[model samples]
Target: MLRFALFVLFGSVFAGCASIQPYYTPNPDIAANEVEDYEGPLDAELVAGTNIAQRIARREAADYAFIGSAAFTGAADEDWTSAMVRLGRTLKTEKIDYFTWYAGTDTATGMTSVPVMRTSFGTVWGPDGPRTVPVTMLDTDWLPYSYTVPRYEYRVLYYKKRKEPLPMGIRYEWPGEELGRRIGTRKALEITLVVPGRTGWKNDLFDGDVILAVNGRTPTKELMRQFCRAPAGGKLKIWRDGQIVEKTISADPSEGK
Candidate 1:
């Protein structure tokens, strides 16, 4: 009876140890060097007119047109219409078109339970004296694992038509490239277009101009947002032809550009 009790106690201890141990395995689906790269064309092409000139004319006639694209990070099951409405409200515009959406790879890590095999070697009493026996048991325990996952990015081209004039008559890169005149000395955000004769304010700013600052402050994301929301115009410090020049911007409240 005492020997049987010892065996039961030994089994209980082995079970407890097995339950506490952990096992881990690599997730095979995600590779170490895997990255999300978007090679497709941006949703900037006009959806209305047939030729470039006609497209520009149609866009100018519209109250607002999506000139460029912006991206927003969201969940896999995120509702797109609601997101668009929210974005429009934030930008103070109701018109949006030329929409594009996609998902990108992200990484997630967590601990989870996994099954493992536990083996034990011990001695047991038998009719032929002490006998060695090998025992194997299937068990489950918690382990840490990491892998790449898919996250959604919502992108769209939006336009706004309002009587209020636009603060600036230029189209800038939303994720703009940083340009410098003297390497580390003179830096500015690259501007893509300055519509000729479309600006509300009177200034000598032109297309391909690099903006260094706005109203004497360094241009930042928040500053850009302020510019977008501003009904009136502001000052712009531009880098043109190896010189920094200040231009006073005005707003045009007309329906057409």
Candidate 2:
């Protein structure tokens, strides 16, 4: 009986010791060699709660936050509707979640690298073009003090329109290569392949392998956004087992699955 009592006491003490031990999770802020959209796991306590606008505000300035632009596609003409449509799709995919005007030079000869933001909204291709406004005039419901502020500053809105087809095609890359410039190239784009269960092909996609391309296109920030449009059930061209293998992969938003 005394031996039984002593064992019980020891077990209780051991359980208490285990209960008090600290828990550890990987730090999301650590600069990973590979590029990722979010700083940490989407499931992380802080990240899961953050909204799209908040993410943009954290990365860029108040002015830059509101406005988003992708380089204009197709030939420029009196008709700018095509550009607007393309801009809308890009904005939707980015979850910019709001709308605004498109900005560019009159000729449209030189365009910005990713996209260009305009101070105000105006007609796409009317005789006078879209009306323009100041960035300071813009307002955001997400902003904490937008109501109480003395003078509000402006932000740029993304505008994609329907335009005629261009002779040359263009593409964009994301999580942007800009990240590669910050962290070393060795850590670039090496993430565990998250896909739906139990197919012979998916099992072959072991973690730590690098993605060489998507349908023979270089993985760019813009290209990734396009890829997200058809995210699930797409063919992934990856380098594995000392060779390149094309595998079909699917991941839904619900599971991050």
Candidate 3:
């Protein structure tokens, strides 16, 4: 009888402890009304280390993925096919934390597509690395001037030896190697093209010398357009080693004149 009474008393004590005041409180940073904002368990979905592929996949589905239309030709160093392959490989590896949205390329023309999303998502990774969406573009009037923005976005416009290089911009790099940082700038396309001998690009007096200027203008896009109608083999002045070099064209060079 004594043991049974003791057991009953212990059970009563445990039950009473179980019903103690609800004393657990949230930290000051988290407001009571904001608890619903957390969708998943805490600390479960953060990206800790480098998972290049996973990051790309998540960004691919994000609304901030390349939006609208971006030029996707194979003329430059990075063409549509190459970009798609790279991006697809990135998506295949990364573990997705959330279903942000989707981005695609046009099947016909190979243009890159923009992100489609319902709710706002955060930083997403690309083949390059993690990136945040441009929050400013969400505003109403930011559309019209936007077209000019990407044109000047510096990229390495790498092209074939004979063709023009394309643009591929990077945000950060090692110190003192900041090249190809801008596209539409005045000197963005500055390059040294070697001219062949005795050809239209050769200097008149100095054999094998380059035919630098065309129609009294330097080798620039604006100048080329102005002299478009002029015939090839036209007289041009060039500067080499800070000296004025003159050349006589033997044949007409198209496009670039």
Alpha carbon lDDT of each predicted model: 0.49, 0.34, 0.29
TM-score per prediction, in order, is 0.34, 0.24, 0.23
Q: Which has the greatest TM-score?
A: 1
Q: What local lDDT does model 3 show for residue 81? A: 27
Q: Output the TM-score of candidate 2.
A: 0.24
TM-score-better candidate, 1 vs 2: 1
The CA lDDT at 198 in model 1 is 59
Please, what are the lDDT tens digits per residue for candidate 2 over residues 88-147? 332332222222233433332332243344466444545776665445243333222212
Candidate 2 vs candidate 3: the lDDT winner is 2
TM-score of model 3 vs. true structure: 0.23
How badly does each model clash, as a count of residue pairs? 1, 32, 21
Model 1, 127-174: lDDT tens digits are 889988999999999999998776754444544442433335554543
Structure candidate 1, residue pairs in collision: 201-250
Query: Judged by lDDT, which candidate is best?
Result: 1
Ranking by lDDT: 1, 2, 3
